[model samples]
Target: MGKIFTVLLVIVGFVYAKPEIVIEDPWVRAVPPTAKNTALFMVIKNVGDDPDTLIGVKTDISKMVSIHKTVNQNGVMKMVHVDKLTIPPNSKVELKPGGFHIMIMGLKRGLKIGENVKFTLIFEKSGRIILEAPVKMK
Candidate 1:
């Protein structure tokens, strides 16, 4: 009985272990059906000891999702594509408006208010993270 109890304790610890990466306040902007592009915002925290690379993202709402960063060139603001975003260990990355964000292009359907968009955040080390991002104005 003691051996069985020990095994159970180990199992529970593994099951309840915290994830190396965490996401906070994930959301997608509500857009009209006619709108061609939209974006997703979130705060990603890496609490692990090793770095991870955010390689890609997937969503059924658009034809493709890619990482983008807003940059000011001369006096004009522009959005540029990012091949990959690295999240250093014990660091936080914010994907917010007028900054680094995820671009969802060629949306198949309009996003309704209060609805949720299925998002899959792919990482090089930590693997896939699937979550539902709520649609909101801000």
Candidate 2:
């Protein structure tokens, strides 16, 4: 009876020891066909007790997909590449314009409004999350 109880406790603990990540309101900026770059915005929510880190992003529409943050450098606004983005336990992170965003560079084609683009978000704890973001002119 003692061994069975111990095993059950361990199993329960393992089940709860993970990050629950949710992506919400994912969208990409709609740009003209001549445009070569665009951005993606979304809200990332971590509802679990464990924290998670967004390490990478993948998409076929662009040659490079990366995490970036807009910053004011010497009174000039610039987008800087970020290595990773962390979402704390039970908290949320917003990726919006002039803030933390996913930069899609060297686009093969322009993003049309009302169209969806598939993206694979790689997280440290939660692994890869596949989702589609619609193109909008927000």
**Each model's TM-score, in the order given?**
0.84, 0.88
> Number of the top candidate by lDDT?
2
Model 1 clash pairs are none
How many residue-pair clashes does candidate 2 contain?
0
Candidate 2 Cα misplacement greater than 4 A, ranges: 1-15
Stretches of candidate 1 off by over 4 Å are: 1-19
Put down candidate 2 lDDT per residue, 29-132, tens digits, no spaces.
99888999999999999998889999999999999999999998889999898999999989999999999999999999877899999999999989999999
Cα lDDT of model 1 by residue, 1-138, tens digit: 999999999888766643378999999988777998999999999997667889999988889899999998997999999999988888999999989999999999888989988999999988999989999987
Screening candidate 2 with a backbone cut-off below 3 angstroms (N, C-alpha, C), the clashing residue pairs are: none
